[model samples]
Target: MNARLRRIVTSAMALSLAVPLAACGEEQTDAGAGEKTIGLLLPENKAARYENFDYRIISRRIATLCLECELDYRNAKSAVDTQKMQFEGLVKKGVKVIILDPVDAQAAKSWVNSAAKKGVKVIAYDRLAEGDVAAYVSYDNESVGRLQGQGIATALGSQASTANVVMMNGSPTDPNAPSFKKGAHGVLDRKVQKIVSENDIPDWSPAEAKKKMTEVINALGPEGFDAVYSANDGMAGGIAEALKSAGIRNVPLGGQDAELPALQRIIRGTQSFTIYKEVRPEAETAAEIAFRLLEGKSIKSLTSTTADSASKSGIPAKLFSAEIVTRKNLKDTVVQDGVVRVDLLCTKDLATACKSLDLN
Candidate 1:
């Protein structure tokens, strides 16, 4: 194996082993009496990770911690009003704690206040919801953006000095988007020749990203931009389709959320890299926090430190580090963790690519 590949594999393995070990070392307790209910509110269904990974892992962890703990699940489906209704319903159900990945971070402030009034404890999950909450759990988001930027810069190498880049960012309403954009700009501003265009994708919608990409393509033409900074894997696919429609190939795109299609693109050399924040550990951490809150156990010892939200500061939080997933670490990271099963990743069309990577 090449030195670069070997180094990546070792790093990935080390990081992979560290996650579960750290989680196992954390304090855990069994659920007791009164059949407490915990509400889980996810932002939207557009991102495959929410349903395929986040929900499953969180549900499994919650179940493991508390067999009889009632889970009230709801998907906002990208509607702020829908999420508001769901939040209200969860509060009405008198859930002990609500784990929310809000549809609109700013708008959700009112909802958080409402929940607080009703004596419901909220754990902001994945996406940090504004206003007072008991805890926050997510990957270090700004670092996610920095990794995306650094990946694009590294892919272009010396060409980065003169490379015109386009940034297709996530939902303006998402609290994380600003952090992602800020982190990316911190790197790209110093490296790139010029940012040809940058857009905030409302709702983090793939269709919106595609539409914005198409607009960018029309303005910049096929060869105008050297790379694209896609905020997440969902938007990365749309950006890829836009580039393909314009007959632009292999433009060194970067994404987060190591979704299957993004990894496939990395293998085929369409996308340069993606950030993999292991959702299992993130979910498990959130579950641990929720259980402790419900059981009236102190969480001061488990969390790294407190986080500052728009409405409030010093909110307790558990933040996980993210790994940049390139072709080099594909086997050692996602594949090794079974985030995406080999059978699923190695589809008929991706079979040859999978074998080339020794993923078969």
Candidate 2:
């Protein structure tokens, strides 16, 4: 069983034994009691998700929830120090609540502590940081990994017994990466024949993933691995390109993030599948939590359950479910949600593929 399932079972058993603990009552400064500034610190801008979806949805929800509220947004560009500096600047500016998607989960602890000292609440977003935080909002990350692994296994089927698999994971700095890796391994290790190459992506950078894939290709040869377990769509793109450059074709590649390009690749049969975690709900939930904190309101009512990070226990969290997007449900999911337009998806080269697959 995955951590989520285990946790759910544990939570059920512990419910009767649960003792009422004092909630972290809002600590609104004099300035914060009125018009509030909420800091939105995102980890990077490279992934289209942050710029295209996360920021827009979260900002819009905050605007809808609180009219007088202002969002001070900053992208860290995948730099831990830069993120720390941006967070400190928000503190100096007296933002009441900060919703942070950390570049480095462990390193963000110091900033979380600093914000606490000033009576400011820090809500960990997307990726859980290692600290005593106000709240955390993200998808069930282990489920994402399981989906990716299952996709690859489904694609390969009986070949899974003989085929070598390459596991391409996300950045080591982000805490969620390990959960994803563990979850993928949970399924892959038992089903797959062998894992020939596995490596951690330095920054979850496509360029880095491409370079690493190229080296892996050279070392393992073109026909060595029959499947790839790409942690997310960005790295999947890199892996796909590397395979194409090496003249490898029809190799099953699994990814998360359900990026447009990866979805396009799935339709064209160049990639196998991608996991889609609807960002709208996650973003809105975090925004709502921040608004509540600023208004001196309790957030315990908003939480669905609790999660643990490396350094904290029983941290209040709201983790959403993830869906696997393949050729089977492309139209039903991302396309229907307007995450990708039909015209954009069926353009030029993909027109025939889209039509043949009844993607319209």
Candidate 3:
């Protein structure tokens, strides 16, 4: 056998001999080649998960399955051009496969096509890039919007009938923003009095969200808003800060991504609800699928459905569910799944609140 083929055989045997790694009731291992390299291109450092969870878990899994397999990692820092350059570099490095969370879906299509031409398989890691891809793994993102809306409406309760809220949306640059807005608006549109004002913030920045919230609060006069649907937790903090400065009390707030302070605010009754996307399963599952394709194995069991992007059709997709955590189900949702480290969320400051949720 050729050296590369022999290496593949040896690595496959070693991986088969090891127990499939498990977290949150699923198993994953490298299936195909023994000692091949994979490239992982993440979008930015602005979102904490890209570095903290995604990088660590994907690297660990590759190490467990094939000790010699290297991960050529890069962070685009939210630059589309930089990502394209990185993707080209990975292709030049002769990586067997690439897993990418794109900086911009539509802008990255050319790179995806170029890599395909060179015979390097591409997996759309978290964000779906616009192209024919090997596979995709993410949560029910639209459903998350619906949940956030419901959470706000529920928190508003009787007030929803007359509630005038503003929306602080994610970056306009992200394709997901429109879908998330669509989902939230679907529920909120029917019940709420009106959207007093709204803007799609650029780059999903907390600073920008805060600035927007302040501007809206001032423009709307001192009567203030009944609630705000800040797309993610970081931006939610921004809205909350604006609200507090204006002395708006007992107002419902909507958020997602379950950043720690947001959940704590839910406990403190400072914020209403946050959506938990639970990245571990999505990250691990994507890594496993990439490994399978490298090993020349089928991934039918992992993917029972599909996703359609503007540039691709019949893409094998794994869509997981999302949960809306009020102060009520914090334990039942994120904590129950072991998605977040309790020690981190349930610190000395939030210790009582964590026990209140029965998380420990």
Per residue, candidate 1 scores C-alpha lDDT tens digits across 1-360 of: 355664564354344332221111211233332238777889889878787667766776677688767666778898999889878766665666989999888898988988788677899998889877889998788888888889999999989999999999988889999999999999999999999999999877788899999999999898889999999988988999999898898789999988889998998888999998877678878988899899999988768888898789999888888989998889988887667778988889888888989997
Model 3 segments more than 4 A misplaced: 1-35, 339-343, 346-360
Could you tell me the lDDT of residue 264 within candidate 2? Answer: 90
Candidate 2 on 65-158: residue-level lDDT in tens? 8776777778899889989988887787677689999999999998898779888889999999877699999988988888888889999998
Ranking by lDDT: 2, 1, 3
Tell how far residue 81 is off in model 1, in angstroms.
1.0
Runs off by more than 4 Å, candidate 1? 1-35
Error of 2 at 227 (Å): 0.3
Residue 17 lDDT (model 2):
28
Off by over 4 Å in 2: 1-35
TM-score, structure 1 vs. true: 0.89
* 24 Cα displacement, candidate 1 (Å): 30
Clashing pairs in 3: 8-34, 32-295
List the global CA lDDT of all models. Answer: 0.83, 0.84, 0.79
